[model samples]
Target: MPKLLITGIAGGLGRLVAKMARSRWEVIGVDRDPWPSAPDGVVVHQFDMRKRRFEDVFRTERPEAVVHLAFVRHFRSDPATRHEINVEGTKHLLEHCAEYGVRQLVVVSSSYVYGALANNARYMNEEHPLNASRTFPEIRDLCEVEGLVGTFLWRYPEIATSILRPVNTLGHSVHNAIGNYMKIQMVPTVMGFNPMMQFMHAEDLAEAVNVALEKKVRGVYNVAGPGAVPLKRALEEIGRPYFSIPDTVAHTLINTLFSLGIYRFPPGAIDFIKYPCTISDKRFRQATGFRARHTLAEIFASVAP
Candidate 1:
């Protein structure tokens, strides 16, 4: 079997992707977090990707394919630390892939890269500029990482580099910003605005990654779930009640909560609920024939409290 190296294999989404890959490839994983007693055929190395030792994995394992998922997305750590882990860490990984003769690379980016601006299109495409950092500078690391990967895609045409910007991901295990925001008690929203939001089941995302690797897809694409729903409807589907605050005071209020560690999302993210950042997966679906199988109910249940 061909060797496949999966970064962030300790994560829930990583495990799901790894589960789907082990049967087809010799799966090797590297993560700063430990996955004790990993299953057979999946060798998980525990360490930071930025560490000098990471290069050794690429040199020794020489994986033909690579799946990048090692971002510090949950925001549990400090911003400086997250930036180093996400942006700087990915720089090392890309260098390793180019130096180690890897043939394929799949970068799991986010649809949120196209900021939830008031002027955003109904279903933005891959060509849409990434403005996420314009307002939500807190998550600029993600945008920067995507930019780096996109540039690498063009620089190293020899490697089949695929960048998948999946919409908000929801699952029982995987932790995402949207999922975290939805899990809040009395999920807060700015009054007079209920933006259309897109979500994909965790398993569906794992399958998307599988298709990208199996097809050796190159270039950028957006991945979506069954469809879009209003922010209120998503909460209603999950049986979670939400409260609306005046838009005037929403930012300050949310910012205070975030500083106090009571809110999962920061004030900059409040604009998401106010504006639409929904995406079109036409390019991805047309290329890969991948249709998300999970229903809205199934997606909501995964994140239900």
Candidate 2:
């Protein structure tokens, strides 16, 4: 069986990817922290990419492909380190992958690269240019990661790369992030009037990664849920109430809470709440032949208990 290396196996998405690929591939999971449990065929390595060199691990494993999910999702602790891991870490990973002659590389990226704007309403295709100016620090940093992948793909055509831009993904055992408040019956803060939002199940995203690895599809693809709906409707679908909050008030409260160490938000996470983020997955679906079996209702149903 071909070998596959998955970074950050301690994460929800990383675990899902390992489980999805275990039956077919020899899976090796690398993470800084110890993972609770690994899939049957997975070998978890307690490795920190920040302090340790990953090239040694790559050469030892000699993976046929890689699923890069390691990232700094939060920037509160160390802004410089966040950029180092997300941006520089990616550069390091890509250079090593190219050197080792890895066949395909699957990079998981967020949709925030598009920026927070209503004009991004249309299903954003892979060809769409990322918004260069983003106010949020974390969003700007993530945008750098996306840009790095684009550059990597252009520079190294020999190594096939599939960049998946998934909207809000929720699943059991994973941190729900924005969708969690709705699950608790609290008024989910809406930035403005009804704004359409789309999301995917983490398991589905894992399956899509598997397909990408197997097919070696090169290029960027937007992978979202069935369709887009108003944020209020999404809250209702998940059995939660929605409350409109003024942007000024919300931002003030959010900043205040963070300053007091009461609550913290990723740089761009709040901006996302204020705007609609909808992407077109037509090309992604057609290419991977992937379908989301679980609906928002099913996901919420499992969480309700």
Highest lDDT: give the candidate number: 1
C-alpha positional error of residue 231 in candidate 1 after TM-score superposition, expressed in Å: 0.8
Candidate 2 lDDT tens digits, 1-305: 99989988888889888998988899988888778767566888887786555888887889988999998675455667878888888888888899888988999997767866756756777777777245566557777888888898999898899789888787776664554545555674755467677777778778889988877899998888656667677777666665677777777887887777666565346657666667788898889787877786775554543
What is the Cα-based TM-score of model 2?
A: 0.91
User: Candidate 1, overall lDDT?
Assistant: 0.91
Q: State, as a TM-score between 0 and 1, how close model 1 is to the true structure.
A: 0.96
Error of 2 at 4 (Å): 0.2
Give candidates' CA RMSD values in order.
Answer: 1.4, 2.1
- Local accuracy of candidate 1 as per-residue lDDT tens digits, 67-149: 99988886667779999999999998999999999999999988988999999999999999999989898888988998899
Give the poorly placed runs of model 2, Cα more than 4 Å off. 179-185, 259-261, 266-268
lDDT of 2: 0.77
- Estimate TM-scores for all models: 0.96, 0.91
User: Which parts of model 1 have CA positions greater than 4 angstroms off?
Assistant: 257-264
Which residue pairs clash in candidate 1? none
